[model samples]
Target chain A: MINAVKREIPEFIEGYGKVKPFMGAYANIGDVVKTSVKIKSVKPNDKKVLPSIKDALLKCGIKDGMTISFHHHLRNGDYVLNMVLDEIAKLGIKNLTVAASSIFPCHAPLVEHIKNGVVTKIYANYMSGPVAEAVSKGLLKYPAIMHTHGGRARAIESGDLHIDIAFIAAPTCDTYGNINGVEGKSACGSLGYAIPDAMYAEKVVAITDNLVDYPACPIEISQEYVDYVVVVDEIGDPKGIVSGTTRITRDPIGLRIAKLAAQLIDEVGLLKDGFSFQTGAGGTSLAVAAFVKDIMKKKNIKGSFAAGGITGYIVDMFEEGLFKALFDVQCFDLKAVESYKNNKAHQGMSASMYGNPHNKGAVVNNLDVMILGATEVDIDFNVNVTTGSNGIIIGGSGGHSDTAAGAKLAIVVTQLTKARLPIIVDRVTTVTTPGETIDAVVTERGIAINPRRQDLLEKLKDSNLPIFTIEELKNMAEKLTGVPEKIEFEDRIVAVVEYRDGTVIDVVRQVR
Target chain B: MKIVRPAKAGTMESNDIYIMVYPNENGNEIQLDSIVLKQFGNQIKKVIMDTLNELEVENALVVAKDRGALDYTIKARVETAIKRACE
Candidate 1:
C-alpha cells in the first residue's frame, strides 16, 4: 500500500500526524479481503456509440463544483478546452475547477467563463497572455494554483487533485481508445502531457478528429485508461503546434553567441562520442545545435542521444546518423511528428520521465549538455526566463531550470541586449534557474564562466573564444551602451514564478 | 504605396535631422511630432546604424510606425529607403 504512493508516502504520513494502526490490523488485511465478495468487471455495451460531449459529461456524473482536467499538448492550437467549457457554461455549471497542463494566450476565451461564474478555480503548470492578465487583475473568485510540470504529475498521482473527468485531445485515436499523437492530421507530436491526466482521472474521454481502424500504432495512452471516445471535426491545428522561425540565427551577433556556446561545450571536453545534448527550439539555441552539428561532423563523432522537445533539425541529425536515438518529450514541428510516426529509434517520453527530480533516473540526468535561453542573466549566473525587464510576465520557465540543473554542462545563450535593454543585469527580474546549475553564460559580446566551475575555467583558458567574468561582461556592456534605466514595478505581485522542483523562486509584479 | 518626399533637410548634425515617413499600403499612419521623434532619436539612430552596417548600406533616413513589424521587416524598410535615396 505504501509502495503505491511511493514518493508521496512521506507527505501523507506527515499529514496524518501520528495516526497509529492497531498491532493486529495489518495481519487481518489478507483474510478480510479473501472473505469479501468478489466483483466482476462489466464492460460497456459494444453497440452503443459514445454520446456527445454534453451527454457524455452528464453520463460521467459531472456536476457543479467538480474538477475537470485538460491537457496542453496542442498548445496554442487547442480548441477542446474552450469548446468544452462553453458547453459547460451553457449547462449553467457553476463553481467548476479547471485543471489544465498549461494555459496559453489562445485560452483567453476562458476569461469569459471565469467571469460568468462557470469556472471559479484553476490549476495549471503555466499561464500567459490575457489569461494571466485576468488573473493578475484578480477577476476570478479563487486564486489560481500554479504548479510545475513535475509538481502537477505528483499532485495527480498522490490524489491531492482528484479529477472527475479528463478531456484528452488526442491527435489520433481508435474506436476502442488506443491513442497516439503521431498518426492523425492534427499530430502535434508526443502525447506526453496527457499521460498523467488520463491515468488519474476518474473518467477519461478521448476526443479526436482522426479515428483510426481497430488499434492505433504506438499507443501513447492505452485503451485501458480511456472511458469514452468522441470524434470531432477538428481537435487542433498542427501549424500552431510549432511556432514559426525555429531556424538558426542569421544575425552575426546571435551566430557569435551560438558559436561561443558550442566552443565552450567542446572546451569542457563534452563533445566526444557517447555524449548527450538537449537544446530548446529557440532561434539562438537552434543556432548552437547547428554549430555543434558541424563540429561533430568534422570530428566524426556521434552522440548517444539528443533529448527534450524535438525539432526537425534534431530529427534530421538522427536521420543523418549523428545521434543513436532521439528522446522526445514533445514534438515541435511537422517533421518531428512525421519522424515520430515512422522512425523506430525516436521515442516519446512523459513529463515525469523526462524531468521529475524525484524519479530514480530521469532522461535529464543523463544529459551531457543543455543550451537554454534567458530573458535576463544576473552576474551570479542565475537565469530568468519568466519575466521581462519591466517585471511583466512575458514567458514561463518551461524546462529551463530542469534541464539546467540536470545536465552536466548548462550553457545559457542570449544576446547582450534586446530592444535597447541590457539582458545581463546585477539581478534578474526572476530566478527560474539558480546560479549553481548554470555553468556558463554566452553572449554576443563574450562568454562568462561561472566562478564555481574552476575545472571548466581551467579547460577553456587557452581557447580562442574571448572569456570574461560575468561582472566584467556586464561592465563592458555598460561601457558600450550607457547604463540602462531601472524599471519601476508596482507593489502587487502579479504571478509567482515556480522552479521545476516546485519551489517559488520569485514573484513578478505589474509594471508601474 | 504612397511615397512622401523627404522633408526639406538641413545638414545631418547633432541637432538637425531629416525625418522620412512612408505610409503602409493600408494608409495607416502613426503620427510622430518632432518632440516624440526627438525623444527616441538616439536609440533609433543606433538601431538603424547598426542594421545599415550589418547590411552594408549607407545614406538613408527611415521613419517607420511599426504596427507589428518584425526585425527583418524593419531591415527591409530601411534597405528600401536607402535604395530610394540613391535613386
Candidate 2:
C-alpha cells in the first residue's frame, strides 16, 4: 500500500503487524477518548521506598512479555534504563518491549538484549549509535517503532501503547515518591517526557539518586502518580545529562545558510513583536537562533516564547528579555536547568502539550517559525532525518515532524552538498516529515520556499537574499555532486516511521 | 613509472582521499574504503584505475580511503602517490 507521501508500505509488515498508511497531515483528527490507568492506593502507614531495582520489579509484579517504558531526560548520562534492563536480563525475562522516549550510544547494551531474545521489540522517538546500527541490520525480533516525541505521548494516552511498568529516572525524589528533575546530583531539567508515562503506566517507579525528605519541594510528578520510589547509588552522570553551553556553528557554510534562513524569516515579517520560535540543538539550528537574536535585538522586538528543548543560548535570550517566556519539553544544557529552577518564566510542559496533534492546543501551534536540520530534503520538500543515504538508521524524528506541521513557517537549513553528496536529492532515502507540512528549505546556495507556500514565495520575491525553487537548488547541487547510485536493501523491514498522527509515513528496510 | 618503495599522499579529511601505493609482483591490486562508496564508489574506483593506467603503474598495490573527494582531488592524490613511490 502507498502512504500519502507515496512510499510503498506493506499492508501487514512481518514484525510490525498491520500498517496504517498516513493519509495526510491532519488525517487522524477526531475527538479522542482518553483511556484511564488502573488506580492503586497507598495507605498512610505503607511505604513506597524500595532498597533496589530488583525489589521494585518484584513489587510491581513485572512479568515476561510485559511492556516497560522509560524517559530520556538524562540523555547520554542515563544509567537507569541499562541498570534496570541488566537486572531484567538477570531475572531471565523474555520478549519484553522497551518503549523508551529516545535511545543514545549509552544504550548499546540494548543490542545484546535484542540479540538474546530478552527484548523482542522497541519503541523510541529518536535512536543512534550501535543499537540503531544493529536494528538496521535486522537484529530485533520485531520492527522498531520510531514515533515522534508527540506521537509517543499520544500512543501512551490513547492506549495504543500499554506500558505495564514505567521506570522514571528522577534526578530528585522523596521517600514518598514525589519527584523532580532539578535539585539533585544528576539534575536534568524538565521532567516533561516522563509525565505521560507516570500518568498512564500501570505501575510507576521513580528511580532516583537523591532521595530527599518527605514532601519534596517543586514536585513535577507528584507522589499520587508514583507507586514505588527506589533510591540508587546514581541515576545518571551529571556531565552527560547536561552540557555547559551549546555553541553555534563555526562552519562558514552553516553560518551562511543560517543567515539566509533568519533573513527569510525576517523578510516574511515574522520577526516582529510577539514572534514565537523553535529550533533544534543542531549547530546550524543554534546558529539560526543566534542570527535571529541579532534581528530581534536590533529592532528591539520582544518576542512571545521559544519552545522545544530548552538550551543555554535560549535561556540567555529569555534572560535578556528577547522572549517573554520559554516552553521547555527538555533541558539541553545546565544553564537552562538553572533557569527552569529559578525563573518562573522558564515553564515545564509535558510532551503531550508540547506537540501532540490530538491535544486541544499545543505550544507548537503558537510557533511563528521553526528552524530545522535535515539529512536529506527531496525535491518535494519532504525531509529525512531518520536514515542516511545508505538507508541506515542514524537518527529519528524526535520533534521534527511535529513542530514542522504546527509552525507557520517551517524552515529547513542545510548545506547544499555534504562530503561530495548533495543534501537535496531527487527523493530522500526516507520521508520523516512530509512536504505538505514544510514551508521552506534554506541552503548555502539559496533558499527555496515550498511551492505550496506561495504567500512566502511572493513575500520573499523582492528580498536581497538568494531565493530559488527547490528544483533549481537540487539541479545546482547535482551539478557539483552527480546523481548518486541507488542504494539497495533487504526485503525484511527494519523499522516503521510513524507520522505524528499515528500513521505509517515510511518503512526502513534492512541494509543489504 | 616503475614502483619502488611504499609511499602515501593526502590526509583523511572531508572531501579528501588518502592514497597509499606499494610495489607489487602482480599487475594491479586496488582496495578502497570510501564514505561515498554507496553512490560514487564505482566512479571513484574508475578514476583511480584510470589514473594508474595513465601513469603506467603496473605491478603495484593501491589502497585509497576516500571521504567524498572530487575526481580531480582523487586523481591528484593518486598522481602524487605514484610520483612519491617512484622516487
Candidate 3:
C-alpha cells in the first residue's frame, strides 16, 4: 500500500501487527471503540499504596510479554521510565513491550534492555538519543512504531494498541491516587500525555515523589482512573523538566527567517482579532512569536488563543492581552509551568483534544498559523523532521503534521542548508509532514509559497520579501553547496515513520 | 604564513563547530573529531582542509571538535580562528 506521501507500506509489520496507509488528510475516519476495561469490584479497606516499583509491578500482576506504558512529561529529566524498566529487568521480565508517549536521552538505558530481550517492542510519539540510534542500526528484533500525539491517543482509544499496565510519573499524588502536575518539586505544568493512559490502561500505577494528603489539588488525572500509587524519591528534575527560560533565537539568519514568517502572517490578514497560533519551542520558532508579538501589540489585535506546547513567550503574550486564552497540552519552560499553575486562562488539554482528528473538534483545527522546524524540506514541500541527512532518526512528528493539517497557514522555518547539506532537496530522506498541508517555506534566503496556495501567493505578491519557487530555492541551495552525494543504507527497515493519520509515510532503513 | 599564536573559535552547541589553531613547526596537520563522523565526517574534514588551503596556512595544528556543523559554518569559524591566530 502507498500512503498519501507515496511511501510504500506492507500490510503487516512483524511487531506492530497491521499497517494502515493514510487515505487522505481527512479521509481516514471510523468509529473509535474504547477497548481497555478493568474489573470494578474493589474493597473499601484496600490500601492502594505500594512499597516500591517492584511491589507495584507485583501488585499490578506485570508478567512477561505484557504491554506496559509510560508518559514523557518529564522530557529528558524523567526518572520513572528507567526506574520502572530497571525493576522489570531485575525481575527477569522478558518480551515486555513499552508504549511510552515519548522517549528521551535519559531513557537510553532501555537500549541495554532491548539487547537483553527484557523489552522487545517500542511505541512512541517522539524518540531521541542512544535507543533511537540502536533502533536505526536495526538492533531491535522488530521495527519500532512511531505515532503522532493524537494518533497514539486514537490508536489506544480504537483498541489498536492496548496496555496491560500504565506507569504514570506524577509530580503530586494522594493516597487514593489523585494526581496533579503542579504541586511538587518536580512540577512539570501539565500531565496531558498521561491522562489518556490513566483513563484507558487496564491498570494504572501513579508514581510520585510527593505523596500528599487525599484529594490532590487541581487533579489533572482524577482518582477514578488511578488503580495504585507508589511513592518514589524523585519523579524528575524540575530544572530538566522545564527550562528556566526558553529564549528566542540569537542567530541573525534565524531572526530573519522568523521576521519573514511573522510578516507573512500579517500579510495574509490572519493577524487580526480572534486569530489562533501554534509554534514550537525551538529558538527560531520562539523568535517568530517575539516578532509576531510586536505586530499584535502594534496593531492591537487580540488573538483568540495560542496552542500546543506552551512556552513562556506565548504565556507572556497571553498575559499582555495579546490572546484571549492559552490551550496548553504541555509546558515547555518554567514560566509556562507557572502560568498553567496559577492563571485561569491557561488551560490543560488532553492529547485527543489537542489534535486528534478522530475527535469532534481539536484546538489545532481552529489554529490560524503554525510555525514549524524541519531537518529537510523537499521540492514537493514534504518536510522531514524525523531523520537527519545521514538518515538517522533524531526526531518524530509530535504535532508537526497535526497542526499543519489543521492550521490555515503551516510555515516551515529553517535554514536553506544545515551542516553543509542542502535542506531543500529533490526528495526528503523521510516525509514526516506532507507538503499538501504546508502553505509555505520560510528560509533566511527567501520565502517559498506552496504552488497549491494560489490565494497566499496572490496576497504575498506585493510584499517586498524575496519570494521564489521551491525549485528555485532548491537550485540556489544546490548552487551554493554543490550537489550532495546520495546517502547509502542497508536493506533492513529500522523503523517505520507513521503519518498523523496512522499510516506509514516513510521507513528508515539500517544506516551502515 | 605561520600562525604566530594559539587561537580558538566557534562553540560547543549542537550544529556548531569548535576549533583551536596553534603554531606548529612539524607541518600543517588538521585533527578532526565529530559526532556525525559516520555520516558527514568526510564533508566536514574537506571543508576544514579547503579553508586552510584557501587561507594558504602551511604550519599550524588545527584541532576541530564538531557537533554536526555545516560546511559554511565550519569555514566561517576556521577563518575566524586563522585571523585570530595572526592577531
Candidate 4:
C-alpha cells in the first residue's frame, strides 16, 4: 500500500499483522476500549512482598509467548529489564515480546536473548547501543516496532499492545507497594513512563532498592495499581539515572545552528510573558536552551513553564524565575531531580498528560516553541530520527512528532551533513515526523522555513539572519559534500516506525 | 615537504575522528579504523589522501580512529594534524 507520505508498505508484514500505512499527520486513529485484568486483592493486613525476581516471574505465570513490559526511567542505569529478562530466559520461556518504554546502551544483553529465541519481538519509543545495532542487523526473530511516547500510551490504553506483566523499577516503595521516585538513593525525579504500565498491565510489580516504611511519601505510582512489591539490593545507579549536568555544545557549527533557532523563536514572538518551551537534551538543542534563556533574561520576559524531559538547564531557568513552573515528565539530570523533589513549582506528570494526543489536553499543546534534533530532513521538511544515513535503526521518535504537531513553533536543528552524507536530501531514509507539522529547519548554513508557513517566511524576511528555501539548503550541502549515493535495502523488513497515531510511517528493511 | 614532528587532532567522542601524523620514510602511508567502515570507509580514506596531497606531505604516517565523523570534520582534523606535524 502507498501511504500519504509516499512510502510503499505491505498491507500485512509477516510478523506484524495487517499493517496500516500512515494516512496523514493528524488523521484520527479511532480508539479501542479495554477491559482490565480482574484482580482479587489480598487483605489489608496481608504481606505483599515477593522474595526474588524469579519468584515474581513465576507468580506472574511465566509462559511462552506472553508479553512483558518495562519502563526506562532509569535510562542507561536500568537493571530491571536485564534482571527480569535473565530470569525469564533461565526459566526457559521463549518467544516473549518485550515492550520497554526505551532501550539504552546498558541493555545490550538483550541481544543475547534475541539470539537464543528467548525473546522474539520488541516494542519501544527509543533504542540505542548494541541492542539497537543487533536489531538493525536483523538479529531478532520478529521485526521490532517503534512508537512515539504518546502512541505507546495510546496503544497500551487501547489494548493494542497488551502487557501480561509489567515490571516497574521504583526508586522508593513502601511495604504496601506505594512507589515514589524521590527520597531514594536512585531517585530519578518522575515515574511518568511507568504510570500507564502500572495502570493497564494485567499484573504490575514494583521493584525497589529503597524499601520504606508503610505509606511512602508522595506516591507517584499508587498502591492500588501495584499487584506485588519486590525489594532488591539496588534499583539503579543514581549517577547513571541522572547526569550531573547536560552541557551545551562548544562546536562553532552547532552553536551557530542553536543561535539561529533561538532567534527564530524570538522572531515568531514566542519569547514573551507566559511563554512555554521544550527542547531535547542533545548538545545543539541544549545550546538552544542557553541561547533562549539569555534572550528571555535580556528581554525581561518571564515564561509560564518549560516542558518535556526536564534538564538541569531548564531547572536553572526556573530557579532564576525565568519560568513560573516546570511540567516535568522525566528529569534528565541531578539538578532537575532535586527541583522535582523539592521545588513546589516543579510538577510531575504522567506520560499521557505529557504527549498523549488522545488526551483532553497534553502539556505539549501549550508549547510555544520546541527545539528538536533530526537525523535527516527532506525537501518536504519530513524529519527522520528513526534511522541513520544507511537506514539502520539508530533512534526513534520519542516526542519528536508529538511536539512537532502540538507546538506552535517546531524547529528542527541539525548539521547540514553528517559523516559525509547530507542531512538535507530529496527524501529521507525514513519519515519519522511528517513535513506538514514542522515549522523550520535551522542549520549552520542558513534557516529554511517550511513554505506552508508563509507567515514565518514574511516574519523572517526582514531579519538579519540568512534565510533560504529548503531546496537551496539541500543544494548548499551538496556543494560542500557531493550528493550521497542512494542506499540499497533487502526484501525483508527488520523494523517498523510508527507515527504518533500508530500508523506505520516507514519500515526499516534489512541492510544487505 | 616531509613531516618533521608528530602531532594529533580530534577526540574519541562519537561523531568525531582522532588523527595522529608522524614523520616517516614511507610515502603517504595510512592506517585507519572506523565504526562506519562498511558504508563510508572509502570516502574517509579518500578524504585523508586528498588532504595529505593538498598539503604536499609525501612522507608521513597517517593514523586515524573514526567514530562516524563526516567529511567536513574529517578534513578539518586532518588539516590541523598536518599543520602541527610540519611545525
Candidate 5:
C-alpha cells in the first residue's frame, strides 16, 4: 500500500511537465479529464436556507497565493468579483493574483486588496477605475499585464496563465455546473469571454444565485469543464449590466460629426444595398447609425449585416429591417442581450469569429463602413486611442485596428480639440491604428481626407463640404489649441499591440 | 442670405439652388430643394453626377419642422431653400 501511494506521487508530479514523455502526454489530454480516484471536491452548503458565499469559498480551498479569475460579463453590474474578493480578504489570503478577463469601475474594491497585499498582480485585457489610478500612482508592486481579447485566450491555451481557480459568476447554473448567461436574473449574454478561463483553469467554480434543475439547455460554458458549483443570493444588479448613455446624441456638434461621417460613406459611394457597417456605442457613432438608417430608409436599401460589440441602437436597426443580421461578439446592454437571444438575425460571435486576424474571413473583413473614435489623429492619419494628453494609458484599441483595416470606409469621428488639447498633431503619442488603414477623419472644425484617397477628394470637390488637407487640419487644430508637449519615455515594454491579422503593430512601454 | 457660385461649369451651377428649411427655431427640422432639378429632373441628375466627379460634396442645409411630407421630401426642401438663401 505504501509503495502504491509513493508511485502515485511521482505520477502526479509527472503530469505537470516533470518528465519529457509526461509533457508530451499531457498535451493531448483534455483540460478536464475524468478520474476514478475519490479526490475531495467542494460541494454546495445546503444547511442554510440562503447559503453564505464565505462558507462556499472556504469549501473550495481558496488559500494564499492562489490565482483566482472572474469574467467581465456583468461589466459594471458585477458584484460577484468584489463579494468573492471581500470574502477572500476576510479569510486572510495573501499574495494572490487576480486574473480577471477585464477590470471595470465596478471592480475598484480591488484597489483596497492591492493595498492590503492580498492581491499583488493583475492580468486582464482592460483595466480602469481606482485600480488603474492606483497602478498609475505606482501603488502595486508588480506591473499589470494588459492583453487584447485574443491575446488573453492565447496566453491561457499556451499555458502562460495557469489559473489555480476560476470563479465564474453565472447568471444561471445547473446542479452539475451547466451555465448560460441568456436566461438568468442578471442575464448579461454570451459567455464568450469566459469560455477559455472555464476550460483552462486548474479548478473551475461556478457561482450562481439562480440555480436551475439538472441539464441547463443551451449551455454556453459546459458542465464538463466546471469542477465545483456554489449557489448564492444576489449575484449582481441587472440594471448595472447596461450603460445609460447608449442613445443617439441630440447635441449639435456631435450631430454634425455624425452627419459628416455618414456623408463620407455616401460620398465614397458605399451607401448601397448589401453594404456592411460597424460603429461604436458612443453618442456620436449612434448618431451616425441614425443618419445611415435614414439614408437606407430613403433609398429602400438593405445591408448584408452589422457587426461588432452589439448595442441596443444597432439591434433596433436590425429589428427595423435596415440590416439583414447582427454578428454580435459581446452585448453592450440588456436590450442587446435580449435581441441576441430572441432575434434570429442577431447572432453571438467569438473573438476569433469577430476580429482575430488569424481567423478565416472575420466579420470585420466584410465591413463596408466603420465609424471609429480616436484620442488623437496625426497628419499621417495615424490614430492614438491608448494614451491621453499627459501620455498615460487611458484606453486601448478594443477593435480599432481590426475594423480600420477591414472596412472599406474607415471614418474617424472626433472633435478637433478635447479639453483644449489639439487632437490632430504632428505625431500621436502612441499609434493604435496605423495611417494606412484610416481613410478619412471627421472633426467639428473640418473634414480631412487622406491624400491616399484622391478619388474621394475629387468626388467631393464639386460638393460644398469644407474639405481640407490633413496638414491644414493639423495646423488649424494647433492654432486653436497650442501644440501639446511631447511625452518622454524610457524603453521597457509593458504591452504589445497586435493588429487584427496577428502581426505586431507596436509595443507600449512602461513610462519612466 | 447671399448666393455663392461654383467656380467651374458642369458643376452644381453657381445658381443651381439647393434649399434647406428646418421648422425648429434652432434649425432642428431640415428640408432640401433644388430649382435646377425642379425644372429639369434629368438635368439635376447630370449636375449631381458632374459635380460629384469634380468634388465630393456631402453638404446640406437643414430646415426643421416640416408638418409632414412623402417621398421627394429632402430633395424638394433642398432645392427651394437654396433658391431662397445664399448658404
Candidate 6:
C-alpha cells in the first residue's frame, strides 16, 4: 500500500503484523480517548522505598512478556536502563518488551538480551549505535516499533504502548517518591520525557542517585504517580546528558548553510516579535540557532517562546530576554538544567503536552519556525533521519515529524553532499518526515523551498539568496556526488517507522 | 612508480580516503572498507585503480579505507601513496 508520502508499504510486516499506512500530516486529528485502570489506595506510612531494583521488579509483579519503559533524558550517560535490564535478565524474565524512549551507543548490552530471547520486542523514538545495528540485522524476534516523540506520548496516553513498569531515572527523589532532574549529581534538567510513563504505567518506580528529604523541593514529578522509590549510587553521568558536539559549527561551509536558513526565516517574515522557535543540538543546527539569535538581537525582536529539548544556547536566548519563555520537554545540557532550576520561565513540559497530537494541544503547534537536520531529503521533500545510506538504523524521528507538522515554517538544514554522498535523493530509503509538512531545505550549495509552500516561494522569488527549485538542488548534488547505487536490503522487515499520528510511514528492512 | 617501501597517505577522518600501499608479489591488489561501500564502492575503486594505472604502479598493493571521499580525493590519495611506496 502506498502511504501519503507515496512510499509503498507492506500491508503486514513480518514480525510487526498489521500496518496502518500513513495518511497525511494532520490527517489523523480529532478527539482521542485515553484509558487507565490502575486503582490504588495507599495506607498511611506505607513503605514505598525498595531495597534494590530487583526488589522493585519483584514488587511491581514483573513477569514474562511484560512491557517496561525508560526515558532517555540522561542520554548516553544513563545507566538506569542497563542496570534494570541486567536485573530483569538475571531474574530469568523472557520475552519482555523494552519501551525505551530512545536508545544510545551506551546501551550496547541490549543486543545480547535481544539475542538471548529475553527481550523480543522493542519500542523507541530515537536510536543510534550497536542496538540499532543489531535490530537492522534482525536480531530481535519481533520487529522494533520506532515512533516519533509525539507518537510515543500519544501511544502511551492512548493505551497503545501499555507499559507494565516504568523505571524513571530520577536525578533526585524524596522518600515520598517526589522526583526532579535538577538537584542531583547526575542532574539532567527536565523530567518531561518520563512523565507520561509515570502517569499511565501500571507500576511507576523512581530510581534516584540523590535521595532527598521528604517533599523534594521544586518537584517535577510529584509523589502521587510514583509507586516505588529506589535509591542508587548514581542514576546517570551528567556529562552524558550532552549528546555529541553541541557547539556552533566552525566549518565555513556549515556556517554558510545555517546563515542561509536564518536569512530564509527572515525573508519569510517569521523572524519578528513573538516568534517561537526550536532547533536540534547538532553543530550545524546550533549554528542556525546562533544566527537566529544574532538576527533577533540585532532587530530587537522578542520571541514568544523557544521550545523542544532545551539546550544551553536556547537558555542563553531566554536569559537575554530574546524569548518570553522556554518550553523544555527535556534538557540537552547541564547549563540548561541549571537554568531550569533557577528561572521560572524556563518551564518543563511532558512529552504528551510537548508534541502529542491527541492531547489538549502541543507546544509544537505554537512554533513559528523550527530548524531541523536531515540525513537525506528527496525531491518530494520527504526527510529520512531514521536510517543511514547503508540501510542501517542509526537514528529515528524523535520530534522531527511532529514539529514539522506543527510549525509555520519547517526548515531542514544540512550539507549538500555529506561524506561524498548526495544529501538529496530521488526517493529516500525511509521517510521520517513527510514532505507536505516541510517548507524549505537549506544546504551549502543552495536553498530549496517546497513548491507546496507557494507563499514562501512568492516571498523569496526575487530575493538573491541562492533560491533554487528542489530539482535544481538535486541536480547540483548529483553533479558532485554521482547518482548512488541503491543499498540492497532483504525482504525481512526489521523495524517500522511510525509517524506522529501512529501510522507506518516506512519500514526498514534488514541489510543484505 | 616502482614498489620500494611501504607507505600510507591521508588521515582516518570524514571526507578523506586513507590509502596504504605495499610491495605485493600478487600484483596490484586492492582491499577496501568504507562507510559508503554500498553506494559508491565501485566508483571509489575505479578512481583508485585509474590513479594507480596513471602512475604506472603495476606491482603495488593498495589498501584503501574510504570514508566517502570524492573521486578526486580517492585519486589523489592513491597517487600520493604510490609515490611514497616508490621511495
Best by lDDT: 2
Model 1: how far residue A4 lies from native, Å? 32
Q: Is the docking of candidate 5 incorrect, acceptable, medium or high quality?
A: incorrect
Docking class of 3: acceptable
- DockQ values, each candidate: 0.05, 0.83, 0.26, 0.28, 0.01, 0.83
RMSD of 1: 10.0
Candidate 4 TM-score versus the reference: 0.91
In model 5 chain A, the worst 10-residue window by lDDT is: A1-10
Error at A81, model 1, angstroms: 1.4
TM-scores, each model vs. reference: 0.78, 0.98, 0.91, 0.91, 0.71, 0.97
The second chain of candidate 5 has a TM-score of 0.28
lDDT of prediction 1: 0.72
Off by over 4 Å in 1: A1-49, A141-146, A243-245, B1-87
- The per-candidate count of clashes, in order, stands at 0, 0, 2, 1, 34, 0
Interface RMSD of each: 10.5, 0.8, 3.2, 3.2, 21.9, 0.8
Q: Give the docking tier of candidate 2.
A: high
Clashing pairs in 4: A419-B70
lDDT by residue for model 3 (A19-49), tens: 7777767777666555746745458887888
- The list of candidate 3 runs beyond 4 A from truth reads B1-87
lDDT of 3: 0.88
lDDT of each residue in A55-159, candidate 5, tens digit only:
666766788888888888888788989988999999999988888877878888999999999988777666667676676555565656555665465556555
Task: List runs of model 2 lying over 4 Å from the truth.
Answer: none
Displacement of the residue A250 alpha carbon in candidate 3, Å = 1.5
> Model 6, residue A125: displacement in angstroms?
0.2
| Candidate ordering by lDDT (highest first) | 2, 6, 4, 3, 1, 5
| Candidate-wise lDDT, in order | 0.72, 0.92, 0.88, 0.89, 0.68, 0.91
lDDT of model 6 at position B18: 94
Model 5, first chain, TM-score of 0.82
For residues A400-467, what per-residue lDDT tens digits would candidate 6 score against the true structure? Answer: 99999999999999999999889999999899999999999999988999999889889987898998
